[model samples]
Target: MESHILAISGGGFSVEEKAFIDEYLLKIPRKQEPLKIGFIATASNDAQGYIDEFYTAFKTEQPSHLTSKDFEALNIQEVVNALDIVYVGGGNTQYMLEIWQKTRFDIVLKNAYQNGVILAGISAGAMCWFETCYSENEEEYEEFKGLGILKGSLCPHYNDEQRRIAFDNWATTQKNNILYTLEDNENLHFKNEKVVAKIRT
Candidate 1:
């Protein structure tokens, strides 16, 4: 039961990112229960209205065709093996990686987050779940390519204003991974893969 990821920061939604998704669902791990949520917004359907305002903040339960054009007619390995928490909203990262690789949904969302589910995303769906993404709409900054399920380089619409000068020019290039900058109710949690916590709204 290893699941936990939160990456918010889009055009809206932030009461401290809904109090960090209610303290990141009380840090999960409570008998896994019937918590089968999986709202991968396929990139801004108004992020399914911020996943229906996160069901008034936590205790998950989204599923009734929650946008991404209904996950472009689902079927990505049965929607990541009937998910357990996969929230990915935010908009237009090359049209949400062209409809999430035309419904391939990035190999069933990285094999349902390495067989434990629980993956989050925001702002261009947390910059395409990182692995490289700096497309500050041309004019110089650019680095595309993602869905590596986190491993560096994801600068969502941080501090707005057209991505605050491209996240301060990708925090001065010379990249080599690790570069998250999702302000507007900041967040950065990862479980089995590391990064325990860093939420700041």
Candidate 2:
């Protein structure tokens, strides 16, 4: 069992990025077809629109089952460990971290990775995989603590953010930690806690 994590930068659930995502997920190591993917949408507080988008994006794949793992359920560990892949949705980074911590999902996620589960996400989901995240938590982007499964920090939607012009400034001024930036289509993939490749879009 080894770690496999995908930090997707954009088109998390939108139809527009389906082609890339399909190919991406398809290429990842899987036990079998109709991969079991769990969507952790706690950041969005189990918002229906986000859930709908997640299913719509992966509809053609006909996954074994798509579920919202963060909506709070029984046998949480068993449910998470059983999945082939876990996809996290983006929204309110600050609140998402709070809930995940309170519920011990952070620990569960780390264990899942160790057990060879494929973990993936977008925006806040992407940023959370690192030691730190450069978040736009309150209008302007600022650095925040993260899960640290991967090293350093990450910034999502690099090209689309209004304050992106100051990215270099922000990174240079950070008191500590290196910041990894991501464009809408860029994705980071890791194996056993090490980067195998960065699929640049």
Query: Model 1, which residues run further than 4 Å from truth?
Result: 1-7, 10-75, 87-92, 99-101, 104-119, 126-136, 140-158, 164-183, 186-200
Query: Model 2: how far is 102 from its true place, Å?
Result: 1.0
What is the per-residue lDDT of model 1 for residues 34-138, given as tens digits with 9 covering 90 to 100?
566656555554444566665555544444335544555546567666767776666567667766788666777787777877777667766777777776443
lDDT of 2 by residue, 111-147 (tens): 8787878888888888888887666766766667789
Worst 10 residues of 1 by lDDT: 10-19
How does each model score on TM-score? 0.31, 0.86
Question: Per-residue lDDT for 70 in model 2?
Answer: 40
TM-score of 2: 0.86
